[model samples]
Target chain A: MTTPTQQRLSLIDVVNRCDSFPYPSDPRLERLSFLTFIVDEIPCGRIHSSVVPHIVAFNQQDRPVFHITETTISFMPWLADYDSRSDAIAQMLNIWRKAPKSFPSLSGWRDELYGVYTLNTSPLTTKGGAALAIERSACGIFGVHAYGVHMNGYVRTGPRPHEVKMWVARRSATKPTYPGMLDNMVAGGMGFGHSPGYTVLKESMEEATIPIEIARNAVPVGTISYTKLSKDETDSQPETQIVYDLELPADFTPTPCDSEVENFRLWSMDQVLDSIRSGEFKPNCACVCLHFMIRHAVLTPENEPDYLEIAQRLNRRLEFPGCKKWPTFKEEQ
Target chain B: MTTPTQQRLSLIDVVNRCDSFPYPSDPRLERLSFLTFIVDEIPCGRIHSSVVPHIVAFNQQDRPVFHITETTISFMPWLADYDSRSDAIAQMLNIWRKAPKSFPSLSGWRDELYGVYTLNTSPLTTKGGAALAIERSACGIFGVHAYGVHMNGYVRTGPRPHEVKMWVARRSATKPTYPGMLDNMVAGGMGFGHSPGYTVLKESMEEATIPIEIARNAVPVGTISYTKLSKDETDSQPETQIVYDLELPADFTPTPCDSEVENFRLWSMDQVLDSIRSGEFKPNCACVCLHFMIRHAVLTPENEPDYLEIAQRLNRRLEFPGCKKWPTFKEEQ
Candidate 1:
């Protein structure tokens, strides 16, 4: 294994891995294009060309679920309401779940539902409901924007502000996604009914065995967003991670309480940077670390040549819609 | 004037004021397009359609400086090196400076130089050289990317992280640009020969009576970028501001030392937010305050509905090239 001081990947390289979609500067960016996936007149997702034939076949059923055109794949006008669209999509996804060989992404089917929202509608807040809800695992295949919360737990080690150490979690080898990869101290998908702060508190206890009092101290900092396009162009996932920072006491240590994490380790900022440069952390989680570093002044304009580019890439604007209003979250005593 | 609480602008509204360019979602975005300004075969700026006639007239001189095509306006191939291009552009600008009526932007020319740089070359760090240096006031007319440094000085009042106050500055009434506007505690353009850190320190002392020891403690955070396109489409300015945060002692107060600032006042977060919602702060300075609030957890996901959008807008991706590397600086005793 290479030492921590060995040649390191530039910060931009790590960001590019997460935000893998072609930039405007890239040549031939049009070669890997997808059709817009519209639901209830809102552009909610994208559909890869390879998946069009399967959708076309599904449309040939006694009742067509989708209306396909050259440029877009939209829900049938008859499926107007949220419940009808979600049920129809769930029924279709279940069919694919059974034939896992044909739809590889459905092999790890998660029954947990994720809200498909527009700028005006949110399952958690809006009086008008989301466009639809789909199984969490199927979100990437549909190219829908997914939301999550990730918290960086750290401790100030010395008198100076930059002297700090971070709590890092390694994913359990048996986990379905990103098995054995490094992650932030606590992270979880924003399930259909949960607020971001609620998710953070819940994940903190479930994943890190933190007490409610300590976990409630997590502060919502900002967000890091990216659109990850799979190499085969079969998956288009535009995701946003609502980031938080929890400054733990120097004596406090995290213990894993769930199968999601294999173990927890506290490392200095240098160790974390080396791990990030070595691609040990999951791409999005690495981005979260970079976000924390940038905000806390670990990486400055003088030290990181790609400082500005990294900042912009960490917040790539998605064409699809997000919730117009976020739900207010309060800790349950 | 309307009170801060009376029909206040949303956070997204404040962000839109700074980044007022056409997003991909805008339908009529093509109408306000400008041709790319290429220097040494690199896209460094833009040229408004109305200004093409002026360049064409200059090209008619005995020794043409520009080669204008349908899509782009580029410097002549003969002007290869940095000196030749800077001298030639300076000569042309001098001619326009004499006829201030025709070139209205040059009317307030300060005789200060600003570097025109590409990704590979910076006036401060690159050994090769910058593309050229032009008059600071005329950068907007040519649509070049300008750089600056903005510092947010704050004091922590309570044990809690969000319980902090910010130092705000009011621009002098006699200033040329945005006269009497509200600004951050300290801000200045990235002049030709200065580094961002150096600019921050210099401006800290020159604008506000900050000692070198205190200014050196300013921590470099991330950056904020935006493309401000004028309503008439005559000016296209893409700017990047390197952000800094300084934690001031509760006892210290800043007094305006120069004519650039009228005075400095420390305000509570509530007052600052009210001013921001009322559009009382200068556009870019408002963004800086928003960024500071975000990092310090003053504005959170639950409280700010437009949190995600605001974060993305604060770091809008600019197409023009920026410095590939920044210079390192040490505080002088």
Candidate 2:
């Protein structure tokens, strides 16, 4: 008689893996003084953090970028006299580009945009001053929150939906961040111009070679948020990641179409669990996978003792400015 | 061409409907003293509150149920010497039954049991001393959090997968709580001695006449939790609802096997939204429907502005004894 060895992971181990999400300790985010950047007496962004000193120094030569008093910084409304208000911003950004030491980027351009809001409730109030590039917002250059979309792609197998096979992506070794680490099959930033739905569809096709029809059917599950105070306490990185789930047919496979992803492979739940335990998957992507597992009955409440805690902790409260003026492509389309 | 009067809700209005979850306001919960109910030095339940005066006043003739002090109240551990805890609890309940005013139930029985726990690691600690009835716990008589199962039963329809039909139930007029309000097709308190899986199966059969085989397939989705402080500020109703989802065959219909439900109906998403906007469904049940809508992709982030907030708020943080040793029927089986 053969004695069977226990192969199933204990629920606590799975919950622990989900709980082990890593946060980057960027010292720049800490101890920032709040300086509201106002446009025509309305709030546009939090412009003057401790980084304000650096911004002030960077603006020494170019067209007096800001008129800063002790507590507040206001864009010179005369900027409207310029050809484009974005040009005024571009001039400042271009100055920083020359030094490149202050603002670091492998690719100089972050084509994606984000909304900057004001107290005045109308587009006439913006005066061409309501947009920021994708990457700079994470540094909280102007103290604004950023948004994105992440997806958990999976295939079902075994008899009677008994097993989950996750499609995992290995980040390209040459990628700027978390290179060679594991990731979800598709993930992308939700920039100013695109809706969460449009962004997901676009990213799916570009990153995973997933067709538009399949991507359009992706489910909007929920969100995960975090407010990371940079290691120096000068910037606040407040981000909200809207999560999605795309269930692929058993025969479906994901292939990387871009340099961002090195390749894609399907792994059984146990193997995924092993990799997570070994600290392999990108922290946030691991959380997305865990959230999917909890919802799909893969981790039953009975098996997981911390079930309630895990569910509540997955989507933490984000400290982003309340998103009233944010526009999306989904609604516009 | 006739101008079509707008009949459908905008995505934001639907999202706001999900956001309007209300919590009961009670002054007592705001200032309750913490009295740890310890078992072998591991804190188990918060045994006593300002409500203890009321419990003491109600149990005047009982076998002195508690050992109360200025800061704490404890059960007589010697009660464990008795073979059947149900009998001892039954005797106290019988005394309350005679008064009826203090312990009121239309059926005079909750018929629900919740696990009582001690921290020796595993089910062996449950020797019948580890369970309490639902009503008593609600009164803070035992200081334990009650658990239940709530489900969303949906039927898919329409071309392009654009439509979803939900199976909703109307609460019976004579039901003691939230009478005539709408509810999920399947819901039942996870009374003592049953696992989450077992209870879902049992409740599905009794509540919706869902066949056992189909009920067995009800997926363990996630959980929702809230603490309701009573109107008079005397009692705290802390509950952890383990939510489930069972996709019914499009042809299958639920019939009321018990009078707890007046009837079941398959309503399109629009009708459900209207009823929810009018505050017709029990608050938790309405949120569950939104959770289902989100997971099914009926409510997308593009359409709902508060998409992130709604998803995070669905599983509110619960204030129960952290569930480390709670035993469920599934674990036992």
Candidate 3:
């Protein structure tokens, strides 16, 4: 058995030696870095708490060919908060080496870059006896997002120059949890035992009042990451977000169901942009959705003639103020 | 514990008392019949077994509500075979019930006419203990003949007026199990353990070369029934089917992934209708799809100018050699 310090060094060395990290400019290569983070920096303890991590290789056609390695790590924050970074790194390496036992001959790993962060410390268990603590550790999440590029539909005159409609949902004032806040059309924490897609689909029905068929119609855009906030940072909880973008008809109406949402409205893009600029859309929920729109070019400068850069700037300036800061490391190009 | 005979008697008593049995002629009462079958007949087996049953109730908005009753009965050929009639009725109920689990709760079950039928089963079990089974039992069988449809943007012309594009999939010749048979775009055994939608989705992806998104758009039109063919019917397999009405772009192209399809061609509606009329389409895969299309108006008289009566005759004609006999019962509506 290797000491924790030795394990950490071995993992760091293996990661540095492996040519898996992609060049920063190449978006595809970034997956390797993310995979490394999942397999190296994040404690195996955290992963095992939620799901078993498996390295699956897909053919050029995107058909899963085989698994190169598989392992279940626990989501134990204590493992992540070891006194030395080397200790944490070593634990991760030990877990990686053991991963092959579950999935023998896996070709490579796929990275799901975004996940939900929740403070609920639940012990997650699988049928196969793999178990992990979910609340304090990083877990890979999956989900579907209904997404489409919103081109300028016929515009109606409004106070703002561009009358593009933005979908906004009001968090249910009557909800036993998270009452009286503005939120995305649909958002929720991915639970330990559910697929991200299944989780999001469930959330959309529960929160946004979107029909399941309609929700399923939402295309799966790529993923996004939100750093988890720490308890001391703010009253707001720590959570990483996996965001999916969906497009609705400009005239689409949402009827809130359950206690997740109280109401919904179609706001003009300019109004939303102005709200962001004025610090009115202060919640991270709004920021996440807004970021998705920007990343996907759902709302671009050209399309939103009255769109102000200040809104974008404000969104960028907002940080997960409650999240704990990790040691900063430079990535090689 | 009740003996199998006693259990059957109890089930029969339950079915007789429930409003679903003996098939209601009034369309409004038909919906009750569908729900009654689920509540009374479906056994309490897992959803993915060879002989599972289900019931689904829909509100005014067509959102489904599910109820999985726990009951299991032995297959008794000696005791009049209830599988045939019960099969279609049960399947329609399951689809009805399962559909809404995906959406929000709408209205409560009220009086409204709804269609019902049985379909082939698809079953699956994840590495997790979660198991899903869509049984091809008596409840899962049904038929429909839709008319007036176009495929790949091409209108039918020539001797046979309606241009019909039927989806035909050849069972994998290399597959050790169920090899080289004609099948629906989606068809599988009961123990395969996958959802009906998932099974069909896989079928469409594998056999039709349709993208997952596009394949999901295919809508369920209705269902059909076929009597068990032999004394060993419980052991002997009867072909199962679920009908869908899909209207594809006229220019749609299908890229066959494997040799499952020996060759495919677009037949003019007249030819397809002629084939059905002449009994040339046969009882294999092509006929099943054609049967569904004709019942749903995808192969309508107006669309396929030549086969106007084909669908009508199919529903009423019991003499068609390929058509399975409708199950018989002492009580009739």
Best by lDDT: 1
Q: What is the C-alpha lDDT of each candidate?
A: 0.85, 0.64, 0.34
**Residues B282-324, model 1: lDDT tens digits:** 9999999999888888998778878888888899988877765
Badly placed stretches (over 4 Å) of model 2 are A1-112, A116-144, A158-164, A228-236, A321-333, B1-144, B158-162, B229-236, B324-333
Q: Model 3 over residues A110-202: C-alpha lDDT tens digits? A: 221122222222324111111222221122221111111111111233422123465766666676534775556776654333444565667
lDDT of 2 by residue, B118-186 (tens): 434333434433533334333345556666788888776864333778899999999878899999988
Can you list each candidate's DockQ? 0.68, 0.34, 0.01
Q: Which residue ranges in model 1 land beyond 4 Å of their true spot?
A: A1-7, A122-129, A330-333, B1-7, B122-129, B330-333
TM-score for chain A, candidates 1 onward in order: 0.93, 0.74, 0.44
- Among the numbered candidates, top TM-score falls to 1
iRMSD in angstroms, per model: 1.4, 3.9, 30.0
Query: Which regions of candidate 3 are displaced past 4 Å?
Result: A1-131, A135-164, A174-178, A231-240, A295-333, B1-333
Model 3, B1-333: lDDT tens digits are 223343222211211221111221234333221111231232212122222332323212243324334432222222122333234334455555445543111112222211221221211211111111122232222211111111121222322212345544445566443465434444432122233345455666665677876775554332222222222121211222334444455576656665564434455444444434432232433444444444323442223422312222222211111111121222111
What level of docking quality does candidate 2 show?
acceptable
Please state the error at residue B221 of candidate 1 in Å: 1.4
Q: RMSD to native for every prediction?
A: 2.6, 7.1, 27.3
